[model samples]
Target: MLLLTLYIIGITAEAMTGALSAGRKQMDTFGVIIIACVTALGGGSVRDVLLGSYPLTWVAHPEYMVITSVAAVVTIAIAPVFRYLRKLFLMLDAVGLVTFAIIATQKTLDLGHGIIIASIMAVVTGVFGGVLRDILCNDVPLVFRKEIYGSIALMVALLYHSLTTLLHVPMDYAVIITLVAGVLVRIAAIGFKLDMPQFKYNSPEH
Candidate 1:
């Protein structure tokens, strides 16, 4: 139940961010809705496909799509106030990232996968939606440029795996601890402007 609740929140947060991206591009309503849905669901879809998990979440629960669409509309209505909610959005995104990672890790473990693949799928599930959003928005993918997004997902996966598998911690406790730790690490990365070193190269004239 906790995972289900967090899943809804994750998609709504992602959908709102997607709507904001579309608004920045001045897209029509349909474009905004499409981007929002894609941004909210694309990561999980990709993860499922790669893991051979049939019946994707949005497919099985069509209401998730409805929820994402509604979120997009609401975001459009409040577009004017988005600038003031930048930090709030960032924090929500942090929560969404950790939530997605935890859910993906659980799914992978349920499928009898080891921690390694679960960790990879966690990162994919947490970050690929934003990557698709950026690609559609014609911006550099934030995972590649912004503060430690994917790394936080990886950390969440590893921490969750260690707690549940190695330490024999209860699943609920593992989820709560991993979620809090992941969110704090991500927010700290944002607050401290922490990121992986950039690779910059100027090519010789072609």
Candidate 2:
């Protein structure tokens, strides 16, 4: 139940960010709502499938659709208040990443997975939504772009696992610490324009 709440919050934040970014594209209300819903639920859906959970969350509880729709509408109407949508999106994205990572880790642990599996699940949950949103919006996915996006997820998952395993911390504390670390890392990466170096391939000799 706690994980569900956290997932909802993460989805809502991502939906709002999606709506703001969608508005910049001059999408109509329907388009905005569609984008928001997809951005919000995409990752969770992927996580469920990967985790072998049947009847996905949104399918099991339709409230997610209704909530995301309302959030999209409200975000679109209040778009003007947020002048720098990119920065706003980044901040919200960070929150979503943290929240989703915590929820995913908890869920994985609940499913009797070990630390390594739990950490990998956390990364999937944290990143797949943004990847879906970018793909649908015809933009490059942030995880594959000039940012420490996936790395942040990796850090959170590793922290969660380490705390729980090495420090013998409670599940809740482990999740909280992992979340804080993920959020801080995301903010610092954005503030400092940090990114992993890209690999370049040279032409093969004939």
Candidate 3:
């Protein structure tokens, strides 16, 4: 139930982001739909494949795809009303990241994985779809650039592992801690205009 809720929230956020971004780029309805679907399902598809879970989540359920499509259409139609969609996208994405990170960590732990593996899987689940969507749209992935995106994922996973194993915290408490930490970090990042350090490479010898 918890996992399903997280998945739904993540998909909704992804759909909104895709719709806004695609509409901004002047994509047609079909293009918007495609981007939304890709954004919503890309990460879960990769995670399921890696975990050897056949038929993928959306493939088996199918409702997720339908919901994503509808969300894209609605977002596109309402784009004008939501003039600050870029800010909305950032907020929703932050919530979705926290939800996905917690879900991934719990799921991996349930599958009897080690802490390290769970943490890695958590990051993958939290950021992979956004990465794919940005790459396909010819933009830098948020996880790889601006804000403390990947760090939020990593911190959430580590907190889950630490609270659970070291302090022998209950799963529920661990999940709460993970979610709170992630959300706080994300909110702080946005509130303070936080950004990751950038590299400046020397020009190649001519």
lDDT of each: 0.90, 0.79, 0.79
lDDT at 77 for candidate 1? Answer: 89
How displaced is residue 84 in candidate 1, in Å? 2.2
- TM-score of each predicted structure versus truth: 0.94, 0.86, 0.86
RMSD of every candidate to native, in Å, equals 1.7, 2.7, 2.5
How high is the lDDT of residue 188 in model 3? 86
Better of 1 and 3 by lDDT: 1
Off by over 4 Å in 2: 1-6, 84-89, 202-206
lDDT of 2 by residue, 97-180 (tens): 877776777678888998788778877887787788788788888676734666777677777777887889987677667767
Candidate 3, residue 57: lDDT: 71
**Model 3: how far is 130 from its true place, Å?**
1.4
Clashing pairs in 3: none
